[model samples]
Target: MNADGDETPEAAYRLLHERAVGQSPTPGERSLSAAQYDSARADYLAEKRIVAKPGVAIWPPTSQTLMKRLGNGSWSTAMTSLGLTTNSGRTRGTGSFSDDDYRSAVAEFLDAAADGDNRSVTSDSFAQYIVWAKERTAAGAKRPSGAAVRQHFGSWEAAKTAAQA
Candidate 1:
């Protein structure tokens, strides 16, 4: 609760976390292949955005898939060189990364986007990230991963350091 009588939102967050990783599968909710789920979720989100009204609707891909897909992409260069993100994707985690950590993590995410994991993201939100990564690649920062870091280390920098060693 804040200084007022309002209840804190931590419970809602906990509930979401619980759902992300639960004990057993529900009746009809069989465990889905992460890739398939991600693809489907991307499609679903696209449908929502495209079918809606108002401004120039664009559903970017989820940062997870996009980051690994792009392969350190331009994020590392941008963050390291300019202390800013070149790609317009989520950089900060749940506030775990320091500024430097933020830069590294952002680099990792762009790396994914360049690689094209298309699977790192949850099935429910992708389109925009995919579109952004691909678009950026077309414009310049052409990065494309042969194999996703997540496929082995579950992310980019992990795969990079592992490959380095």
Candidate 2:
């Protein structure tokens, strides 16, 4: 539509759609909207936390009573709907980290890390794990079960080296 326009040559309107619709416009000119915007948001959210898919209706983590009730439900129902199931056939002990429980804990840790709250990792649930891991890696922790505490040369050496560094 300029002064030299020949019958107003077709001016294709280029719209920055994706950015306006809450999407990163760093990629293309194709306007992102409708399901695209939703998918992008869903993917981003899923990375930061658990996401119940379209067919899956995972309940928000709450009381242990509700979790136990759901665990006793139909396998398919829990797997497809609430996103859970029990592996009765497994030889795992009664005291074990369930898949969902592990995932939930990991999600919690990630959330805490994202929020920069290192103290948030002090969960009673993972307290045992912390103790176990610390003991396993603790210097001079290994003993014959009845043996007395001894100063480990390795730990002393490591401490001296770190101090010099």
Candidate 3:
């Protein structure tokens, strides 16, 4: 079922077809493989019955729409419930922060901090860095926590040094 509780066989088939094609689904008419058709049918049935009760596991819980509903409007919670993991051992909302992302954030933070002729990376500076990182990151990208930053660099001074490099 779609957001309005309307049956959407075409949408389901499109999802399956796209998964098979390893690409985003395109609009208009398209053919479906036998397996895609069968999977779409199952998905349709699952969608229809998903909200009948609580705690029912939805197969292919990776669907963003379904996750939003299942998470009670929090996509992060839905991802957590689905056991999503990251290399940093942080869950969703804690930031999908990678080393490269951390480095870039640090660089930006250092630049902003140095604008006032303050080269030191103090606690307040680190806090500001978090805000800067959050604001500059792309939409849907996770926002790293202070802890994540510290973990990445071992200390504020180290992060500052790397950023200056």
Candidate 4:
């Protein structure tokens, strides 16, 4: 029990985990995957971003702290060490993407659009590129979206210019 005495250790851990990941832990003996663990850590860090008090340091919790408090190892090693099962049944992308992937997808999309009847980038071209990029990406790999490309290059014309450059 904490100072408040109402929150049990399990409850406290659940609250933190839920806030960090936007969901509660899965029922039964299951552990998070490496990607999922990384995401949770990121969420925890994002949530912990607050103004520090005078003479008081506010540091985000680390994976080690979570491990110690949760009594479990990382998803990769937990299955062997703790005999826990993974909840991820199907392969899915982590949704974290790289700049290179975005740039490459944009280039590919522009090239395809040029080769097609439309020589210029339009909404249809962007949608086609998104489909092409998703098909080219491997299973469980993050795929680029039209919004991601726009965000990366500021606009479709800018993205086309960058690809040309």
lDDT tens digits by residue: candidate 3, 84-117: 3212334544556677777777776666666766
**Stretches of candidate 4 above 4 Å error?**
1-98, 116-124, 138-143
Q: Order the candidates by lDDT, highest first.
A: 4, 3, 1, 2
- In terms of lDDT, model 4 sits at 0.56
lDDT of each: 0.38, 0.32, 0.55, 0.56
Model 4: per-residue Cα lDDT at residue 54 = 80
Identify the candidate with maximal lDDT.
4
Cα error of candidate 2 at position 111, Å: 1.0
Model 2: pairs clashing at backbone N, Cα or C within 3 Å: none
User: Which 10-residue window in model 1 sums to the lowest lDDT?
Assistant: 8-17
Q: Write the per-residue lDDT of candidate 2 for residues 1-165, one digit (tens) a residue.
A: 223342210110111123234443332233332244335445544655965567654322222222244434322222223332323443422224443433343343334434545553444233433443344336553211101011211332332233233
Which regions in candidate 2 have their CA more than 4 angstroms from the true location?
1-95, 119-165
Clashes of each: 32, 0, 0, 0
Worst 10 residues of 2 by lDDT: 7-16
How far out, in Å, is residue 160 in model 4?
1.2
Model 4 TM-score relative to the real fold: 0.34
Between prediction 2 and prediction 3, the one with superior lDDT is: 3
Candidate 3 Cα deviation (angstroms), residue 111: 1.1
Query: In model 1, what lDDT does residue 69 have?
Result: 44
| Cα lDDT, model 2, residue 121 | 44
Q: What is the lDDT of candidate 1?
A: 0.38
lDDT of 4 by residue, 64-123 (tens): 544554545433334334444666554332346666666666776666666656544443
